[model samples]
Target: MSSSERACMLCGLVQTEAEFVSKGCANCQSIFDKAGVDTIDCISPSFEGYVGMCKPNKSWCARWLRIDNFHQGLYAVKVDGRLPVDVVDLLPHYIPRDGSHVE
Candidate 1:
C-alpha cells in the first residue's frame, strides 16, 4: 500500500497522502515524536514488552505489555550500549488498564 494509505497501528487512522509511513498517523506520530525517541522498533522478545531506543541520545524505552495481569509481549532494547530491563518494566504501570488494548 502507498504510505498515505497506511493506517496508524495505534489509532487506525488513515494517513494523508503526505503522511504515509511516518511513525504513525499525525496524532499518534506526534505523541511518539514528542517523546523524543530517536528510533522506535516494533520487535518481539521472549519476555514481555515493547523495546526500542529514544533517539538523539539513544535512550531506551522498553514497554512491557500485560493483558489482565498476564504478560504477553517482549521487546529487546539497546541504548547507548546499555541495557535497561528494569526501566522498561515501568511501562506497564504507565499504561491505562482500561485502554490497554492493542490491535
Candidate 2:
C-alpha cells in the first residue's frame, strides 16, 4: 500500500483515513450491512436505524480511542440537554426494553 493510504484496521484493505474510519469502504460497509449495522450520525440519529455511527471529528471516532463504556459500543449522549440521564431514556431506540445493552 502506498504511504497515502492506510490499511483498514479491521479488513486490512488500504484506504484513506476518511474512508476507513468515518465512512467505511465498500467491503467493510458490506460486512456491516450484512450484520445489520448502520452508520447513522451519533448525536442526531434518525432513531429508526441500526447501530449509531460517529463522525470523524468526534473524539470517539478515532481508531486509537480505547474506553470501558459499554465495550465502547455505547457512546455518551444527552437527554433533555442534561447529563447522567438514564441510558434507556436517552436512547430509547438503542437500549433494549429489558434494560440490557449490547454486551
Candidate 3:
C-alpha cells in the first residue's frame, strides 16, 4: 500500500499524493510558477517552530504534516475538479489543520 494517503480535494478521493498529482493535482502548471514553488520538490526543512528555509531565502518547514497539519499555497486554484496544492512556502491559503488532509 502507499505509505501515506491524503484525500485529493480536487478529485475527492483518499489516495496517495502521487495519485493526485499524476491525475493532475492542479490543472495549470503556471500555478506552481506563480507560487514560485520548485515543482521538483519545493521548500526546505525548518528546525525551529519559526525558522528555516523552504523556498529559496524563505524560512519554512515541512514538519507540519508530522502533526497532521497541511499547508496551501497562495494561488489556491481549482481546475476541472483538480485540487490546488498548499504549502508552497509563500503563504497558506487556509489555516493549517489536520482536517485539511484526509487520510
Best by lDDT: 3
Per-residue lDDT of candidate 1, residues 1-103 (tens digit): 2322322233223334344333433333444454443222211111222332223132222223222221222212211121124323434533322234355
lDDT of model 1, residue 79: 11
- C-alpha lDDT of all candidate models, in order: 0.29, 0.31, 0.32
Off by over 4 Å in 2: 1-5, 21-23, 36-103
Tens-place lDDT per residue, model 3, 1-103, is 2344443322122334464456433322355557654433321111112222223223233333331123332211121122235433444543333234454
Predicted candidate 2 versus true structure: per-residue lDDT over 1-103, tens digit per residue? 2334443222223334455457664433554444443422111211121222244235453342221121223222211111113322333444221222345
Model 3, residue 63: distance off in Å is 27
The per-residue C-alpha lDDT of model 3 at residue 11 equals 18
The residue pairs in collision within model 1 are 3-20, 4-20, 37-54, 37-55, 38-54, 38-55, 45-74, 48-73, 49-73, 49-74
Could you give the candidate ranking by lDDT, starting with the highest?
3, 2, 1
- Candidate 1 Cα errors over 4 Å, as ranges: 1-4, 21-24, 37-103
TM-score of candidate 3 against the unseen true structure: 0.26
82: Cα error in model 1, Å: 23
Clashing pairs in 2: none
Model 1: how far residue 10 lies from native, Å? 0.8
lDDT of 1 at 90: 35
